[model samples]
Target: MVIPPPVRPPRITEFLKPYVLKMHFTNKYVHAQVIHSPTPTVTASVSSQEKALRSSMGITRDVAAVAKIGKILGERLLIKDIPAVTVFLKRDQKYHGKIKAVIDSMIKAGVKLL
Candidate 1:
């Protein structure tokens, strides 16, 4: 008789990429953060909901605002010695418009997309 080898749980968030970039869009604001999947800890984050950013960027739901958020997030990650990240978009989210903008800006800022 033989038994199957242990398999990793399906609920594990990160399998290939250790660092992950998560984003959320609200009625009036956009939020983003980088998390260390294993530890489930946030490494860096930025949002249009932040007081300082809200004061400067009036409209937070626009693609430009999202791009800025991605750039800032990439910079923050690099500052913390994270060189790459994998994006975790929502189910209905597609790699278009604002999503594309964020990924592009992050790549431009020197963060490799995995």
Candidate 2:
């Protein structure tokens, strides 16, 4: 028999009751936001599609860009007085590569992973 690894604290708690991080990826860009789940409102967001990032980054869809996006999100949340957030990945997505980079960078930027 095989066992699935335990889910992490942040990943287990969806935004239905607390702040959550959401991600959107396209062939040309990466977007992310923090949502206040109960009311379904966005608290903070960042995207590689912004003019400032588009001119600075050669590839918006890359892992490095996603990491930068995560860092930005963390900073934004901190400014909003939100110190922690759980990641809310869609069913089609798994935690790896770009997703992992985002989470790691957010932690490095000082956002407590739920």
The numbered model that scores best in TM-score is: 1
TM-score of each: 0.84, 0.82
Error of 1 at 102 (Å): 1.0
Model 1 agreement with the true structure over 1-114: per-residue lDDT tens digits: 999999967865445578988888887888889888888899999989888788778688999999999888889988999999989988999999888988899999999988
Cα lDDT, model 2, residue 77: 90
Q: After superposition, how far is residue 47 of candidate 2 from its true place, in Å?
A: 0.9
TM-score result, candidate 1: 0.84
| Residue-wise C-alpha lDDT for candidate 2, range 1-114, written one tens digit per residue | 999998877643453448888899889888999998877889999999888878888888989989889988889999999989988888999999999999999999999987
- How many clashes in each structure? 0, 0
Q: Candidate 1: deviation at residue 31, Å?
A: 0.6
| Per-model C-alpha RMSD | 4.2, 10.8
How does model 2 fare in lDDT?
0.88
